[model samples]
Target: MAALGSAGPVLLLLAALSVLSVAVFVARLIALRGASAGAAARADWLDAVEGGAMPGAPVGGGAPADRLLARAAALLPRRPAPEALTAELEAMGATEVAALGRGVRTLEIIGLIAPLLGLLGTVLGMIQSFRALELAEGAANASILAGGIWQALLTTAAGLIVTIPALVGAAILQSRIDRATDEMERVIGRAALAAALPRS
Candidate 1:
């Protein structure tokens, strides 16, 4: 606690950013995990839709992918051309992809800024060390100068500690987003193909 105080305000800011990054990561993980877990169910739903069991109304309450597939299934029967229908599905899927990616850019920003904040702390620490030496005139107090430098470097280390994990978490979350997107495309393609087929 004392060390953090000595490291100055930038350290506090980085700490807060670290907390926010963690929260975003956890929320995204839960959402993506839920979507992935429901993959098999989504596939089953797509198969049913292709079998011509269109629901009487819009289906509600399922994974994001399932909901998107349901919406596309409802829209498929309107007999839109395959190209136009595919384009519409892609647009809606893009929206869902964007929703899954919320807060990801914030995490990326934190990762990029944390290291710069650490460098700033290093500069500030060096300034304090020089100021201490100047105060001592010809007889510089080595211990005090070293203490000041040590405290300053603390913020840089803290910044790295926060940055590495935040960036790693962001990467992991991005991969999940990509996976979800691919699944959505596949489901949409299946629905579109079904719509293009002639009824027996």
Candidate 2:
């Protein structure tokens, strides 16, 4: 922390961003975990729908696929138009996908800006070092220039340290959300198909 303080505000801000990035990733990870049922359960739900019955989800209704299926089942008996059912399920799926994607953009922005912040810190450090050298006049030594250069370089390294994990976390979380979205579409589309409620 003291070292971070010495590096200056940009580095300190980068550290705070790193902490925030990890927190967002962890929170999203926990929220996305088990957010979809296993494939077999999904298959069973589709089968039940096709079999002309409204079936309860194998587990909780919190999963995206489960919610979408519930919506379709609720509308099945009404015998709504094929286009209407498709539209409704698609709308619900969009909402679910958007909810899953929350916080992912923050991770991406942090990953992108961290390196730039590091470069800014490096530039600031270099300016201070040059100013010190100018003040020393003929008394300036190699150590003075070298020490400043290395200290200035520290921000660059710190920026990369923050960037890699944030980007990787964003990628992983985004992939999970995408898979859930696909699942929601598949389950709901099949349910709509089985009930003869959609054009496919």
Candidate 3:
């Protein structure tokens, strides 16, 4: 607590940002877990679509890819133009991808700024210590100078501590998004294929 007290306001702000990062990570993780499907599940969905059997009604509570397939299937009977249907699917896919990516940019920004905030704290601490030395006619005691320097460095250390984990979390979340994106594309492609098939 004392160490944090000495770390300065910027460090406090970084700490708050770290908390926000964790919140975003957990929320995104839960949302992605619900929305994403494994390879086997995806294969099953594609097979069902190709067989002219939509996996489920266009209701909620399925993987995002499955939900998209169901929605497209619902629209198939109207026999909309191939290009028009494809365009609509593409737009829906973009929306799903966007949903998966919410809060990701904020995490990335926090990861990037934390280090610079720390560096700023370090510079400020050094300046204060030097100012003290000057005030003391350049005869400031060693302990005073050392203490000030250490206190200033505390923010830098705190910044780094917050930064590394935030960056790792961001990377993991990004990979999840990438996987979800792949699944969405595959599902969209299969839907398009199903639409192209000639009716009996």
Candidate 4:
């Protein structure tokens, strides 16, 4: 309680950032894990449906990629021309990938700002410390200045602690989205090629 009371408003802001960073990281990680795990399998299903002449079924996996595939499967009945099919699939794929990217930019923004905010807090703390030392009329010792400096430095540490995990989580989530994108392209390209072939 005393520690909280002693902390400047900047430290409180940093504390909020730390909590927000952790929350976003955890949620995005879970969502990306599910989406990445389902993407390959859904791709296979989509390829089999469009290329291998297998009867299509609803893709019930609930991932973004799975939903995209499900939408494509639903379109099979119309026998869309190959170019039209490719365009539709490409558009839908872009949308799904974008959907997966939700909250990712927030992580990136938080990561970028946290350290700078910490530095600002430290600067403010140092200003307060020096001002206090001046007001002490030469009565204050080195220990008082030293304690104030350390307290100010605490904000910088807090900022870095929030930033590191947010950045790492953002990177991992982005790579996962990239892999799913590759899978979608591979599957969609092959399907388009197979559909363009003359029937047996």
Candidate 5:
């Protein structure tokens, strides 16, 4: 608490940065989770679509993933070749995955840059400490020296607190991206296989 108080303007700036970073992180988390969950639900959707289910009929009031699968099904012509079918499915999956990635890069950047800003503050604080020492002429003022050192350490701590969560959030979102991509791939593979099956 004292460290933050001693950090003065830099502390406030870091606080603001933290707030913005957290907001971005939360937004990205929500988006990635929603996308991944939707992708996971695609299995049942693909099954229903392949079974001649009505286009608009609820796959048990299916979700966004189901809707996306339905769209892809419509795109696959009655007798599309495996190669063309694969291409179309890949394109659709890429589009959905890209949407899930939105704002993730910003969170990563915040994680990286916040620490640099804190380091800058640390440097400035150390300089102030040395300047005060010089003024004291071989007898540094304990109060001034302590104040400067406090500022240096506090800024660094603040930076780390902000950065750690941001980095963690980025990692989580990245995992979600990978999971979503994998799910989409699986769905596409199943769809292509069904399309290629021989009709009795």
Candidate 6:
């Protein structure tokens, strides 16, 4: 496009960085959504299994939590020791929770690095503007200088746009994970206690 062609090299580089930032943001959003949804489903499944209800036909074939719940229900009745049963269930929950928490590290890294990238872009743009001014034989062109400064500002805005939401999303997902973990601990405790009781 004519407009894009008019953009200086520094602006083009900033645009590329912005695009990359947006892509990372989108990926993180998808990961967080999946983690929250999966955790919710796992909690529901655990609750139903603990209440002695069987899960319905597998949705989209089957989920890992569903397989785990089924396995626990079958083995737990035959397993004599409550500690062993609890240990197995805890292990299963740990793995599922770990999967849910994946991509959190990437989000954190992006949040911390995006601002720095923006700063780098800003510095590069300013350096270019200064070089132009140094080479100018006569008065510096205000329009050219303004354009470079605007590009730097735009890059900073782009970085914040990517980072602020990612940081907040990571926090929200983390809280969801914590709540799910608490629910798991309670459910596992109840199951262990019930198993420890003597048969009538």
Measured by lDDT, the strongest candidate is 2
- Residue pairs in clash, model 6: none
lDDT of each: 0.79, 0.82, 0.77, 0.74, 0.73, 0.61
Instruction: State residue 104's C-alpha deviation in candidate 2, in Å.
Output: 0.4
> Per-residue CA lDDT of candidate 3, range 32-138, in tens?
78566655765775687678775554444457677677677677776666677788888998988887888788888988999998988888778877777788885
Clashing pairs in 3: none
Q: Write the per-residue lDDT of candidate 4 for residues 1-200, one digit (tens) a residue.
A: 24422337777787888788789878877877766456557656756664657565655785665665666667655666778778988998998888888878988998999888888878877886787789887798887677668767887897898888889988988988887787677656755665565554
List, residue by residue over 37-128, the lDDT tens digit for candidate 1.
46776667767767767655444445566766767767776867777778888888888888989878988999999999988888888887
Q: RMSD of candidate 1 to the true fold?
A: 2.7
Q: What pairs collide in candidate 2?
A: none
For residues 41-158, write the lDDT of model 5, one tens digit per residue.
Answer: 4666667657755244334323334544665667554767767787887887777777777877888888998888788778878888878788889676688788788889888898
Q: How close is candidate 5 to the true structure, as a TM-score?
A: 0.81
Displacement of residue 71 (Cα, Å) in model 6 is 3.6
Give per-residue lDDT, candidate 5, residue 110. Answer: 82
Error of 6 at 98 (Å): 1.5
Question: Which portions of model 1 miss their true places by more than 4 Å?
Answer: 1-6, 48-61
TM-score of 4: 0.85
Native-referenced Cα lDDT, model 5: 0.73
Off by over 4 Å in 5: 1-7, 38-41, 45-67
TM-score of each: 0.86, 0.90, 0.86, 0.85, 0.81, 0.68
